[model samples]
Target: MLEPQPTRSEAAARPELTREMLEMVFDHVENGIYLVDGQGVTLAVNRTYEEMSGFTNVQLVGRRLDEMVGPDNLFSGSASLLVLQRKGPVTATYSTSTGRKLLVKGRPIFGDWGEIRYVINTIWDLTVVQYSQKIDADTARSQMLSEEDIITCSEKMMSVVDLALRVAQTDSTLLLSGESGVGKSLLAKLVHRSSERRAKPLMQINCGAIPESLIESELFGYEPGAFTGADRRGKPGLFEMAQGGTVFLDEISELPLHLQSKLLGVIQDRSFMKIGGREPMTVDVRIIAATNRELMDLVRQGRFREDLFYRLNVVPIKLPPLRERRDDIPLLVRYFADKFNRRHRCYKQLSDELVQRLQSLPWQGNIRELENLVERLIVTTAEEIITPADAQLEPQEPELDPDATLGEMMARQERTIILSAWKKHRTTRRIAAALGISQASAARKLKRALESDIGAENQS
Candidate 1:
């Protein structure tokens, strides 16, 4: 099916015309095109690129890409410059003077002598495609993280887990804020386990558990003869020791103000000096800090540094308390019971009625308290089928709020109904339809319910 070739005279006459036609086609192509020589000098660019970048071919053609990167430069940086530096293909995000976000892929072509001849940069508007792709990817990743023994059925908690997994994909500092036993430590481990640095050590230190005097020496290693009773060989700090992994600083709110300042510097610079060492030691470590107390409150009270709090709060992940995620209670109970049963080599089961009762009771201490209660029951009860009375522990009765009026109680009940429906359906329209109310009313009630819960927690 080969086509007839053009005569030599015909081809010769149209060579220049064909080249011009091809160039015209390139200018009209949808994807942005940028071509640069080996020395990073822009050689040719299509109209699509000129339009996308707001940089005309006349201004770009003769200039070096590196010259266009700086405080007063047209570009933040050039992908072609990266291609030149790496001597290979590279992918980057670039921003133009017009504030358009470009996702660029730069490929370098080498000459026969192994020297780069030219670089071709292909670009597209990132907001047009990548933004939606990122959301889809994040949703898929969140589902995977949820499947990893997290044992949560609540959409709210699933969202939290998804966020944690997304942050885990980066080396950015993470701050986990929640009440005690809300599984901050567990989430911290999950982040570490799911991170690029998972192969390395996941060093954990309890800021609250460590003594103040020794904490500095322990965190920032001390040199020999720097302090009395020091070992002859200096010890590396936790940051230094975890060179390529994560350092989970549990109860970070308990970190002294002075130490918090030092932690901030380490986080910002990726370097820290030992307690007694003269030179600053650089470390390639990720910091994952967890706190049972509210760090913002500590900052407001002057017990924590505001600068340090901001540094650690780059990716703040707030964990929902067990009471808020009551849907997970039954799954957790079954998981713990099975775990204890295997450990003790005993066969036991929880009755449906007892499980329901446990789900209804407020788990004030959260997962840790629930686990302990389960283990205690598993070890003490001899019966194969355990009852609520046989467990020998009563649920902590809620204190009566005598200040509340009957109308207020009714409002609280109504709020609960809306919240439960919203949590299950996750859409205002669906929730409203299920509850036989207008979507706007459902949304307003749901917002108030959430705000009320937060207010109650803050008050507590």
Candidate 2:
């Protein structure tokens, strides 16, 4: 028997759900779902529809999708919907009104006549998962963007960050070794947060920041009668406070040699005495130590305990400095811009020239320095746009010979210029005032350089 005739196009059209009809359908969807007609009106939406998005039925019903996205939406402003106009489907991860993440997928839907009638779109909330991922990514990105993703891009830094993640997954002790501000502390914190001990308290202390006299009590705590001004009740040390968690020891190289013996004992035996207590107390905790200074160097200098250094250097994770990964600068700068923008309540656009300047500058201070400079720019710059002028880079005059090394010639030129100024001013203090350096340091460096030159001449 012949199949029933195909339904006619007009009735098959089902009047093609107006953007309004689609909106009503979208409103009921637990997930963010919406339909935009060819003319781009909200055909229908469910109750959840209006709740998640800030728009009301009145504001959204008859409006164009582009207009609905409005001024602040970079998507509309950037002509993202126009991409749908040409491409048939557009998908992206975007931040919404709640500052939450959503996966937006835009697809062209057709009528019975095979005419493209509406763009059915769906948004899936990735707020929690994306946020968790972003935290890890943000940490990895904390290094620098160009350099940010590069941690994984390189086999070496990748191994370091990877080992950090692995060590974070366990309650094992982690040691981060690198140059000053090379992100050792960052890797330690990343390990803490990424590990099984994440929910537990994570305490950080700078061994170098405390005075040598007080270091003992600070690490092990004190009983009421233990010290001259001790409280009636004993206070817990960082290890106890970080019970079931992690304690980060920064600048471990600065830990006194004698104190290193005490610390090594704790690592080996997991036991410590509260200053006045006769009994030894033990608590389970993961330790993550960081040091920009080489413990081996301190060991060679006879200033650090070799045994303690060996104990702390277990699972050593080395972070590369910013100069080694200059490509990460742009990534780091933008991250800083976004960060400082939120902190300072200002949005500053990093201009092309400004980015170029950032690329060129000698970031001897590394990631921390770049972040500080970006925060400073956010605080001080007047225009929303950050330019080369916004960076305030100091201009250095070019020296005479092209063949001369910049390191040597710049110093020579600077000295010649400073000497001329000193002769004109007739005082070291006046010369210091002109050059913006402390008079004592200026005199010292100059004297040393002159003496070194004279010694070289004597050898010649």
Number of the predicted model whose TM-score against the real structure is largest: 2
lDDT of 2 by residue, 1-460 (tens): 9967757975686667799877566566667666667766666544564565554667666666655553255222211253244434544344455554444555677778866687766655433211121212212212211111111122355456656765676666778877666777656655665566665666677887778887777677777788777766666676766667777888888888788898888899988888998989898889888887667877998989888878877787888877776655665666567657766777787787887778787675677788788888889889999888767775755647877777888777766676566565556755576578888977875676567667777999
State each model's CA lDDT, in order: 0.76, 0.65
Model 1 agreement with the true structure over 88-141: per-residue lDDT tens digits: 665555556676656566788999999999999887653211111121221221
Q: How many residue pairs clash in each candidate?
A: 0, 26
Highest lDDT model number: 1
Taking all chains together, each candidate's TM-score versus the true structure is 0.55, 0.58
The lDDT, on a scale of 0 to 1, for candidate 2 is 0.65
Q: Where does candidate 1 clash, by residue pair?
A: none
Question: How does candidate 1 fare on TM-score?
Answer: 0.55
**Residue 43, model 1: Cα distance from true site in angstroms:** 57
